[model samples]
Target: RVSMACCLNMCGAVHCSDIAILGYHRKPPMLDHEYMDKMCEIPLAIAACPTAAIKPAKITLPDGKEVKSVSVNEPRCM
Candidate 1:
């Protein structure tokens, strides 16, 4: 999971394979998953972001495999 935050003092993007999603601003539940390879449901995850900070990306992994994932575009307020 990922979170989009806006702060004038901080820059850069952070990605995490596992995360906790809060419900109704309540306690968040932990989510664990395996490798995030191509064909992952990235658009679905990005769609969940209220800030619209994420977008689908074509990235080459260390293993030389290209995959579709999400990347955060910082410095822009969505």
Candidate 2:
């Protein structure tokens, strides 16, 4: 059986393969806006990103009020 892992954790058993074609980023992080708000401080995430890919943003909810959030520059994310 072939196994692959995105990172060094090697949980998928890539170490077992002499010629493992390990996959990369096949599963991106879940960054849903609702969860982001609850999970982290947006300002800190923005500041910590060295590439300045994250910026302040205002998102309008279903109720039509704007809320503070972060915006990402996809190209700079690399």
Question: Against the true structure, what is every candidate's RMSD?
Answer: 11.6, 7.2
Q: Estimate candidate 2's alpha-carbon lDDT, on a 0 to 1 scale.
A: 0.65
Model 2 C-alpha lDDT per residue in residues 1-78, reported as the tens digit of each score: 666654444545688876565555434344566556777788877766656767888887777867777887767663
lDDT winner? 2
**Alpha-carbon local distance difference test for all models:** 0.48, 0.65
Q: Could you tell me the lDDT of residue 50 within candidate 1?
A: 63
Which numbered prediction scores highest in TM-score against the true structure? 2
Cα shift from native, residue 53, model 1 (Å)? 0.4
lDDT of 1 at 74: 58
TM-score per candidate, chains pooled: 0.45, 0.55
lDDT of 1 by residue, 1-78 (tens): 554433322221324325433223222222222244433466665666566766666777677867666676554333
Worst 10 residues of 1 by lDDT: 25-34
Model 1 segments more than 4 A misplaced: 1-34, 37-40, 76-78
